[model samples]
Target: MEQVTTVGIDLAKRVFALHGADGAGRAVLRRTLRRDQVMEAVAALPPCVIGMEAGSGAHEWARRFRTLGHTPKLMAAKFVAPYRRNGKNDGNDAEAICEAVSRPGMRFVPIKSLEQQALLSLHRVRQGFIAERTGTINRLRGLLTEFGVVLPLRSVIVRRDASKAAEALPGLARRAIDDLLAHLRVLDERIAAYDRELEAQARGCEPAQRLMKIRGVGTLSALAIVATVGDARDFKSGRQFAAWLGLTPRQHSSGGKSRLGHITKRGDAYLRCLLVQGARSVLHTATRHADRMSRWVQGVETRRGYHRALVAIASKNARIAWALLSRNEELRIE
Candidate 1:
């Protein structure tokens, strides 16, 4: 077989499929290996460019492959999907990855370090706890309404009123509500603990600390951005970074005409959400400040409307964040 110069791997829980191509892009080797044999197989091959989807265990594999003197590039599954020629199976997917990685214009996901992966795990767990608490709160509110007691939407009010209202309910109903309330309490405590942990992480991390200097950025947002965006330099500009976060408008153009719609909502939804929320906070207080950023935000709100202003601010913040991260500089609000 011709020397395999590029490889694409379809990673699965137990089985993995690999497609190898020579420098001329001719298929050279195709193989499937069990989980146990994957490492040895890759380690035995001559160092070359390897490509895989940025999902699940791909980062760790990329790190491992890099140690073996191979250039491992990870692409979003959506980007690889276009290259798929046949039915969606392991073999075709691997081939698509192989082709996608070789494209000069193809975008690649930055390989995250162990520290980044660890921090993201914390963020994920904290977010999960928060979601669970929200569900519990909603359930409690719904139950109370059935008993002719309507609770307020605010979590604090719900917690206070629900407990008092639960006391007046019948035996079984009260027990169920009480159990849910207990779970809510546990979730609240755990979420608080995670918040403190994230805050400490933000305080300790220089990049996150710089990010926190922005008007709307806080502990969680700062830390989340720092963790998710491994290397800001991977992006050529702040505008590119904002687009990556899906803060930019979606474009649909033809015949030399340009049409723009709502944000494409691509990339990490969680990160985009945090940015939007942060932007909202900035918009709320823009009136209180006379800074250049505040003025721009107010002008956008005046001309475009409220929600668009929020998105604009979020996009600007994302760009600012990229500049700070890439340049290793502090934010100087003017």
Candidate 2:
């Protein structure tokens, strides 16, 4: 006991490791608890700062701990790794988390609300469906090619010609092709349904609606950003927000010489992908519109070439999104 002031728990499925420190940062408690005993154990202790890595079940635990009068700090696993000493066991990990959470400059992850997690669930499932559909399409193409029926790379063309090509194949091969095409059709329907649901959600969400007004930010991109980034204000600046999404360049500096490389591509790969795709959309149609953003995009395209222009627009859009979400401001087309 010794009046615990801070604690860290290494989370797991069945067993957990706990480390506790007193006011003077001296280790006062170290133990393990089973899954069912965790809540009761923590409830017995006085309210204190609890820290854990941002991973599976971390948010739920954080939410629950808040109700028990405990302050929960969730840190990225990598940040906690350096603090760990000796072997990689639950006890050492918990101890490291205890040490890391007390650091004044250490960053913490924002706890996600149930509503936000729910919307993100939809995104994850929809992405899975899309990936499955892509694999199915590729399989269909590969199967057809083996039977001397060459189809173009386009899905639309495959949909049109697949049936005719299948009709000319041998009996079992034809049946197999038919089945895959049917499966593809089912996946398409499911994906479309998810798209409609997301569109409705975006329509109802004020933040998402505002985000959609930004060029190249469609329903999916807006919703993804909103759901993934719980509170934009957690970021000190738009540049920081962009850096969090791994849209900013990585640095390799030493001896006071500055060196910048490609994007670190470190955080939230899905969100980064969505923003980059939106940037590509902006780049393709920049010539059609005379708006300031379009003009700037065109200039970047000309000066930096296509690929760098994409990153420029993506990073810029990320910054604008941060401003919109954090400051509650409207987009100004100037």
Candidate 3:
């Protein structure tokens, strides 16, 4: 129970590996503790910086460790990857975590609060329901074609066609179509319910409120930002934040020369997707407006086509979002 300076924990389901280094950089403690004994074991030691990978149960353990007077840091797995030397095992990974956290230039993940996690959970559930509904619609469309019925392009039209087809269907096909429709209805209801829940949650958050001032951002984008970026202060700049969300063009450099390429697309896929989809809505509905971003997008569309413009606008939107986030104010889009 000496004064430890840095502690690296490799967490697992039933067992945990702890590697502790003393103030003098000596390997003073190495032990395997049961899941139940983890807190008790750490609590006995003096307060120190505890580094753990952003894995399952890490946040709960982080809260627990912080309560026990230790500073907890969540390290991204990718950041720790370079520290791995030779074979990768629990002990090696624990050592790598130690090495990674000890470095001065390592970036850390901000721990999300319960409310933020709740918002994210709602979005995930809604996404699943939407995917399910889409599958049901496609299946319905495919099945109707077998009976010489061609569905129209629109989803609503397909839905209506499916309903009418079900009514005129034979015994087995009717039952199958009925079951699919029922599931689709249930999914739609679930998605709507979650949207309401998220909207309510977003209303109370200041960052989300500020985000809604932008043209493209709505309840979903606002809530997604609150859920995804837990603390805006953790980011250095709006550009950095935007890049972190995969909203910036990537670069390729060699021999002191640099060339920019497509977006890196290396961070949270969900938030990036939400931002892009929100931007698409803007393109579809508000591109006629005389705003700078909208005008830029229109120009790109005239030259490169629609999707390319969409991505460019989405990246710009993310940058604007980061600016709004860092300043903690409503957007002043012009």
Candidate 4:
């Protein structure tokens, strides 16, 4: 068999499809292997470049392949889609991955370390808990409204006033609200626990600690940024980093004219949301400060409206974060 110069793997829980190509890009091997047999099959081949689509287990597989003395590259699944010429299947997907990996300009997803993945998992779980908590609170408020009992929007107020409000409702409604309020309290405690864990984790991480020094960034935002963007060097500039975070506007240029629309919103929604939330907090008091950043934000709010100004600030913050990480420096406040 011709020396397998490159290999693409279609990963699955039970089965995996692999396509191998020679130096001249000619197919040399196409085979399917059971999950347990995958490493054995790969070990049989001489060291070569291995490509896989970015997914749940992609990073772990990439790390495994690297340990086996092969160069592993994980490409975004969308980037490999254009290479598929036939109906989608494991074989076709593997072949497409093989072709995409050979492209000189194909972008690859960074392989995240276990620690980064762990932090991200925490953030994801915390987000889910927060969402559930919001739903619970909304349900409580809706139920109370049915009985002509309206509480303040703040969660603290809601919690404090819920019991009194429930007393004025029907016995059944009162009991239901009582149960929901209890659940809400539990979720609040869970969310608080997660926040404390994240804060402690951020305090121990040097990059996160540095990120916390930036205005509008707190423990959660700093931890999210550090966990999401492991190596800022992967991005060419702060602008590119911001673009990756989907904070930049989408462009549609044709002929000599250029059309820019809303933010692309292409990357991690959680990270973008955190940055935007931070920006909103900053915008609330930007007019009270005379710093250059605040003044610029104020000017933007005047010209582009408050919402657009918030996005711009978020993008700027993302860029600043990239610079800090890339240069191994802290955020320099002016």
How large is the C-alpha RMSD of every model relative to the true structure?
A: 1.0, 1.3, 2.3, 1.8
Q: CA lDDT, every prediction?
A: 0.92, 0.92, 0.83, 0.91
Q: Of 1 and 4, which scores higher on TM-score?
A: 1
How far off is residue 42 in model 3, in Å?
Answer: 1.4
Candidate 2 lDDT, 71-158, residue by residue in tens: 9999999999999988999999999999999999998888898999999999999999999998988899999999888888899998
TM-score on alpha carbons, each prediction: 0.98, 0.96, 0.91, 0.94
Model 2 bad stretches (over 4 Å): none
Better candidate by lDDT, 2 or 4: 2
- Candidate 3 positional error at 86, Å: 2.9
**Per-residue accuracy of model 3 over 1-334 as CA lDDT, tens digit each:** 5668898999999988898888777777788889999989999888898999999888888988998899999888998989888688888788788778888888887888877777788888888888888888889888888987889768899767787877877989989888888888888888889878888887788888888887678888888887778778788887777788877878898999999888788778888887788878878865568877667777888897887777777777777777878777777756
Model 4: per-residue Cα lDDT over 103-217, one tens digit each: 9988777788889999999999999999999999889888888778888789888888999888877899889999998899899899999989998898799998898888888
Give the lDDT of residue 139 in candidate 4: 90
Per-residue lDDT for 1-334 in model 1, tens only?
Answer: 8899999999999999999999999999899999999989999889899999999999999999999999999999999999999999999999999999999999889899999999999989999998999999999988889989987889999988887888888999999998998999899899989888887888789999999998878888888888889899999999989998888889999999999999989998998899889999999998898988889999999999999998998888899999999999998866
Clashing residue pairs in all predictions, respectively, total: 0, 0, 0, 0
Model 1: residue 165 alpha-carbon error in angstroms: 1.2
Q: Is candidate 3 or candidate 4 better by TM-score?
A: 4
**lDDT for residue 237 in candidate 2, whole number 0-100:** 96
Output the worst ten-in-a-row residue range by lDDT, candidate 1. 215-224
Off by over 4 Å in 3: 145-153, 167-169, 285-287, 299-305
For model 2, what is the error of residue 147's alpha carbon versus the real structure, in angstroms, after optimal superposition?
2.1
The true-versus-predicted C-alpha distance at residue 48 of model 4, in Å, is: 1.9
